[model samples]
Target: MSSDPLDDVFNLEDRFYTQGYTQGVEDGARAGRIEGRSFGMEKGFEKFLESGRLAGKAIVWANRLPKKTAKQKDASEKSSEACTLPPLPSNPRLEKNVKLAYALVEPDTLSTDNSDEAVQDFDDRVKRAQGKVKIIERMLN
Candidate 1:
Protein backbone atom coordinates (compact mmCIF):
# COMPACT_ATOMS: atom_id res chain seq x y z
CA MET A 1 0.00 0.00 0.00
CA SER A 2 1.28 3.45 -0.93
CA SER A 3 0.87 6.22 1.70
CA ASP A 4 -0.07 9.63 0.39
CA PRO A 5 1.90 12.69 1.64
CA LEU A 6 -1.07 14.89 0.77
CA ASP A 7 -3.39 12.90 3.09
CA ASP A 8 -0.95 13.23 6.03
CA VAL A 9 -0.66 16.99 5.50
CA PHE A 10 -4.45 17.36 5.30
CA ASN A 11 -5.04 15.35 8.50
CA LEU A 12 -2.44 17.26 10.58
CA GLU A 13 -4.84 20.10 11.37
CA ASP A 14 -7.57 17.74 12.60
CA ARG A 15 -5.08 15.82 14.74
CA PHE A 16 -3.87 19.02 16.41
CA TYR A 17 -7.43 20.20 16.94
CA THR A 18 -8.44 16.96 18.68
CA GLN A 19 -5.40 16.98 20.96
CA GLY A 20 -5.95 20.65 21.92
CA TYR A 21 -9.63 20.04 22.67
CA THR A 22 -8.83 17.10 24.96
CA GLN A 23 -6.14 19.05 26.85
CA GLY A 24 -8.41 22.04 27.19
CA VAL A 25 -11.20 19.92 28.64
CA GLU A 26 -8.89 18.31 31.19
CA ASP A 27 -7.45 21.64 32.28
CA GLY A 28 -10.90 23.19 32.53
CA ALA A 29 -12.20 20.39 34.72
CA ARG A 30 -9.26 20.62 37.12
CA ALA A 31 -9.44 24.42 37.32
CA GLY A 32 -13.20 24.29 37.86
CA ARG A 33 -12.83 21.95 40.83
CA ILE A 34 -10.13 24.13 42.42
CA GLU A 35 -12.20 27.28 42.05
CA GLY A 36 -15.26 25.51 43.42
CA ARG A 37 -13.42 24.35 46.53
CA SER A 38 -11.93 27.78 47.14
CA PHE A 39 -15.31 29.43 46.84
CA GLY A 40 -16.90 26.90 49.15
CA MET A 41 -14.28 27.44 51.84
CA GLU A 42 -14.60 31.22 51.68
CA LYS A 43 -18.39 31.07 51.95
CA GLY A 44 -18.29 28.50 54.72
CA PHE A 45 -15.91 30.60 56.78
CA GLU A 46 -18.07 33.71 56.37
CA LYS A 47 -21.17 31.86 57.52
CA PHE A 48 -19.51 30.30 60.51
CA LEU A 49 -17.97 33.63 61.55
CA GLU A 50 -21.37 35.30 61.53
CA SER A 51 -22.89 32.47 63.52
CA GLY A 52 -20.08 32.67 66.07
CA ARG A 53 -20.44 36.43 66.41
CA LEU A 54 -24.16 36.07 67.08
CA ALA A 55 -23.47 33.35 69.61
CA GLY A 56 -20.99 35.62 71.44
CA LYS A 57 -23.52 38.43 71.59
CA ALA A 58 -26.08 36.02 72.99
CA ILE A 59 -23.65 34.97 75.72
CA VAL A 60 -22.94 38.57 76.72
CA TRP A 61 -26.65 39.39 76.80
CA ALA A 62 -27.35 36.36 78.91
CA ASN A 63 -24.62 37.31 81.34
CA ARG A 64 -25.81 40.91 81.67
CA LEU A 65 -29.30 39.78 82.60
CA PRO A 66 -30.14 40.11 86.29
CA LYS A 67 -29.75 36.99 88.34
CA LYS A 68 -33.14 35.60 89.29
CA THR A 69 -32.39 33.93 92.63
CA ALA A 70 -29.91 34.22 95.48
CA LYS A 71 -28.12 31.06 94.33
CA GLN A 72 -27.91 32.36 90.79
CA LYS A 73 -26.74 35.78 91.94
CA ASP A 74 -24.01 34.25 94.07
CA ALA A 75 -22.83 32.06 91.24
CA SER A 76 -22.82 35.02 88.88
CA GLU A 77 -21.01 37.17 91.41
CA LYS A 78 -18.28 34.60 91.67
CA SER A 79 -17.67 35.01 87.97
CA SER A 80 -18.65 38.66 87.92
CA GLU A 81 -15.07 39.81 87.66
CA ALA A 82 -14.95 38.38 84.16
CA CYS A 83 -17.88 40.49 82.94
CA THR A 84 -18.01 44.29 83.11
CA LEU A 85 -21.48 44.83 81.65
CA PRO A 86 -24.03 46.22 84.09
CA PRO A 87 -26.92 43.84 84.71
CA LEU A 88 -29.91 44.50 82.51
CA PRO A 89 -33.08 45.36 84.39
CA SER A 90 -35.26 42.35 85.13
CA ASN A 91 -37.81 42.25 82.29
CA PRO A 92 -39.47 38.96 81.49
CA ARG A 93 -39.98 39.77 77.81
CA LEU A 94 -36.40 40.92 77.29
CA GLU A 95 -35.07 37.89 79.09
CA LYS A 96 -37.16 35.59 76.96
CA ASN A 97 -35.99 37.24 73.76
CA VAL A 98 -32.37 36.99 74.80
CA LYS A 99 -32.76 33.31 75.57
CA LEU A 100 -34.48 32.69 72.26
CA ALA A 101 -31.71 34.48 70.39
CA TYR A 102 -29.11 32.35 72.12
CA ALA A 103 -30.94 29.17 71.19
CA LEU A 104 -31.22 30.19 67.53
CA VAL A 105 -27.49 30.71 67.10
CA GLU A 106 -26.17 28.05 69.41
CA PRO A 107 -23.10 26.78 67.56
CA ASP A 108 -23.14 23.26 68.97
CA THR A 109 -26.61 22.56 67.61
CA LEU A 110 -25.99 24.08 64.16
CA SER A 111 -25.01 21.87 61.21
CA THR A 112 -21.77 22.50 59.28
CA ASP A 113 -22.67 20.38 56.26
CA ASN A 114 -22.87 21.99 52.83
CA SER A 115 -25.98 20.15 51.70
CA ASP A 116 -28.92 22.22 50.49
CA GLU A 117 -31.10 21.45 53.47
CA ALA A 118 -28.35 22.12 55.97
CA VAL A 119 -27.34 25.39 54.33
CA GLN A 120 -30.97 26.51 54.22
CA ASP A 121 -31.41 25.72 57.87
CA PHE A 122 -28.21 27.53 58.79
CA ASP A 123 -29.22 30.61 56.84
CA ASP A 124 -32.66 30.58 58.42
CA ARG A 125 -31.19 30.33 61.88
CA VAL A 126 -28.72 33.15 61.23
CA LYS A 127 -31.45 35.41 59.87
CA ARG A 128 -33.64 34.74 62.88
CA ALA A 129 -30.72 35.37 65.18
CA GLN A 130 -29.99 38.71 63.52
CA GLY A 131 -33.61 39.74 63.92
CA LYS A 132 -33.47 38.77 67.56
CA VAL A 133 -30.35 40.85 68.03
CA LYS A 134 -32.10 43.86 66.54
CA ILE A 135 -35.05 43.35 68.86
CA ILE A 136 -32.81 43.00 71.87
CA GLU A 137 -30.91 46.13 70.93
CA ARG A 138 -34.15 48.07 70.58
CA MET A 139 -35.27 46.82 73.95
CA LEU A 140 -31.98 47.85 75.51
CA ASN A 141 -32.12 51.39 74.13
Candidate 2:
Protein backbone atom coordinates (compact mmCIF):
# COMPACT_ATOMS: atom_id res chain seq x y z
CA MET A 1 0.00 0.00 0.00
CA SER A 2 1.45 3.33 -1.10
CA SER A 3 0.61 6.21 1.26
CA ASP A 4 -0.08 9.52 -0.53
CA PRO A 5 0.68 12.67 1.48
CA LEU A 6 -2.24 14.51 -0.17
CA ASP A 7 -4.88 11.81 0.75
CA ASP A 8 -5.11 12.83 4.44
CA VAL A 9 -5.75 16.51 3.49
CA PHE A 10 -8.60 15.57 1.09
CA ASN A 11 -11.48 15.20 3.68
CA LEU A 12 -10.02 17.61 6.34
CA GLU A 13 -12.05 20.58 5.02
CA ASP A 14 -15.35 18.57 4.96
CA ARG A 15 -14.83 17.35 8.56
CA PHE A 16 -14.06 20.90 9.79
CA TYR A 17 -17.24 22.24 8.06
CA THR A 18 -19.39 19.42 9.59
CA GLN A 19 -18.01 20.01 13.09
CA GLY A 20 -18.57 23.77 12.79
CA TYR A 21 -22.19 23.23 11.67
CA THR A 22 -22.89 20.91 14.62
CA GLN A 23 -21.38 23.41 17.09
CA GLY A 24 -23.47 26.27 15.62
CA VAL A 25 -26.69 24.20 15.94
CA GLU A 26 -25.87 23.32 19.56
CA ASP A 27 -25.14 26.99 20.41
CA GLY A 28 -28.44 28.11 18.83
CA ALA A 29 -30.40 25.54 20.86
CA ARG A 30 -28.65 26.63 24.06
CA ALA A 31 -29.49 30.26 23.37
CA GLY A 32 -33.14 29.36 22.65
CA ARG A 33 -33.42 27.45 25.93
CA ILE A 34 -31.89 30.32 27.90
CA GLU A 35 -34.23 32.88 26.33
CA GLY A 36 -37.28 30.68 26.99
CA ARG A 37 -36.31 30.23 30.62
CA SER A 38 -35.79 33.96 31.05
CA PHE A 39 -39.20 34.75 29.53
CA GLY A 40 -40.94 32.25 31.80
CA MET A 41 -39.17 33.62 34.88
CA GLU A 42 -40.19 37.19 33.95
CA LYS A 43 -43.85 36.15 33.69
CA GLY A 44 -43.69 34.36 37.03
CA PHE A 45 -42.15 37.42 38.70
CA GLU A 46 -44.89 39.71 37.29
CA LYS A 47 -47.64 37.48 38.64
CA PHE A 48 -45.93 37.40 42.01
CA LEU A 49 -45.69 41.18 42.08
CA GLU A 50 -49.38 41.58 41.16
CA SER A 51 -50.51 39.09 43.78
CA GLY A 52 -48.30 40.73 46.41
CA ARG A 53 -49.85 44.12 45.67
CA LEU A 54 -53.37 42.68 45.92
CA ALA A 55 -52.51 41.00 49.23
CA GLY A 56 -51.17 44.27 50.62
CA LYS A 57 -54.38 46.11 49.67
CA ALA A 58 -56.52 43.34 51.15
CA ILE A 59 -54.58 43.54 54.45
CA VAL A 60 -54.96 47.33 54.63
CA TRP A 61 -58.73 47.15 53.98
CA ALA A 62 -59.18 44.29 56.42
CA ASN A 63 -57.31 46.13 59.16
CA ARG A 64 -59.39 49.33 58.81
CA LEU A 65 -62.76 47.53 58.74
CA PRO A 66 -62.63 46.45 62.42
CA LYS A 67 -61.91 50.01 63.64
CA LYS A 68 -64.77 51.45 61.56
CA THR A 69 -67.20 48.76 62.75
CA ALA A 70 -66.20 49.32 66.40
CA LYS A 71 -66.76 53.06 66.10
CA GLN A 72 -70.19 52.45 64.51
CA LYS A 73 -71.14 50.00 67.29
CA ASP A 74 -70.11 52.50 70.00
CA ALA A 75 -72.13 55.28 68.39
CA SER A 76 -75.18 53.04 68.04
CA GLU A 77 -74.91 51.89 71.68
CA LYS A 78 -74.66 55.48 72.98
CA SER A 79 -77.61 56.61 70.87
CA SER A 80 -79.65 53.56 71.88
CA GLU A 81 -79.06 54.25 75.60
CA ALA A 82 -80.04 57.93 75.18
CA CYS A 83 -83.18 57.12 73.14
CA THR A 84 -85.14 53.89 73.21
CA LEU A 85 -85.85 52.16 69.89
CA PRO A 86 -89.03 53.44 68.22
CA PRO A 87 -91.77 50.83 67.98
CA LEU A 88 -92.13 49.25 64.55
CA PRO A 89 -95.12 50.75 62.73
CA SER A 90 -97.80 48.63 61.05
CA ASN A 91 -97.71 50.78 57.88
CA PRO A 92 -98.78 49.01 54.65
CA ARG A 93 -96.55 51.18 52.40
CA LEU A 94 -93.47 50.36 54.52
CA GLU A 95 -94.28 46.66 54.35
CA LYS A 96 -94.89 46.74 50.60
CA ASN A 97 -91.68 48.64 49.84
CA VAL A 98 -89.60 46.35 52.07
CA LYS A 99 -91.12 43.24 50.50
CA LEU A 100 -90.41 44.51 46.99
CA ALA A 101 -86.78 45.33 47.90
CA TYR A 102 -86.30 41.92 49.51
CA ALA A 103 -87.75 40.14 46.47
CA LEU A 104 -85.44 42.07 44.09
CA VAL A 105 -82.29 41.48 46.16
CA GLU A 106 -82.90 37.85 47.05
CA PRO A 107 -80.34 35.43 45.61
CA ASP A 108 -82.95 32.73 45.10
CA THR A 109 -85.06 34.91 42.80
CA LEU A 110 -82.08 35.77 40.58
CA SER A 111 -80.54 32.27 40.54
CA THR A 112 -83.72 30.20 40.28
CA ASP A 113 -83.71 30.28 36.46
CA ASN A 114 -80.58 28.95 34.78
CA SER A 115 -81.59 30.15 31.32
CA ASP A 116 -80.00 33.35 29.92
CA GLU A 117 -83.36 34.94 29.02
CA ALA A 118 -84.80 34.29 32.44
CA VAL A 119 -81.71 35.76 34.09
CA GLN A 120 -82.07 38.88 31.94
CA ASP A 121 -85.72 39.20 32.96
CA PHE A 122 -84.82 38.85 36.62
CA ASP A 123 -82.08 41.48 36.28
CA ASP A 124 -84.52 43.89 34.61
CA ARG A 125 -87.05 43.47 37.37
CA VAL A 126 -84.40 43.94 40.06
CA LYS A 127 -83.17 47.13 38.40
CA ARG A 128 -86.69 48.53 38.07
CA ALA A 129 -87.48 47.83 41.71
CA GLN A 130 -84.19 49.30 42.81
CA GLY A 131 -85.04 52.52 40.95
CA LYS A 132 -88.41 52.66 42.66
CA VAL A 133 -86.79 52.17 46.06
CA LYS A 134 -84.34 54.99 45.32
CA ILE A 135 -87.27 57.29 44.50
CA ILE A 136 -89.11 56.28 47.66
CA GLU A 137 -86.00 56.79 49.79
CA ARG A 138 -85.47 60.26 48.29
CA MET A 139 -89.11 61.19 49.02
CA LEU A 140 -88.78 59.99 52.62
CA ASN A 141 -85.58 61.96 53.11
What's the distance in Å from true for residue 20, model 2?
2.3
Looking at model 2, which ten-residue stretch has the lowest summed lDDT?
Answer: 59-68
- lDDT per residue for candidate 2 within 10-84, as digits (tens), equals 989999999999999999999999999899678646544543443343333222222236777687566556654
TM-score of each: 0.89, 0.36
Q: In candidate 2, which residue pairs get closer than 3 Å at backbone N, Cα or C atoms, i.e. clash?
A: none
Q: What Cα-based lDDT does every candidate model obtain?
A: 0.93, 0.56
Candidate 2: how large is its RMSD? 14.9
**Least lDDT summed over 10 consecutive residues: which range in candidate 1?**
77-86
The lDDT, on a scale of 0 to 1, for candidate 1 is 0.93
Q: Please state the error at residue 109 of candidate 2 in Å.
A: 34
Candidate topping TM-score = 1
With candidate 2 superimposed using the best TM-score fit, by how many Å does residue 120's alpha carbon deviate from the native?
31
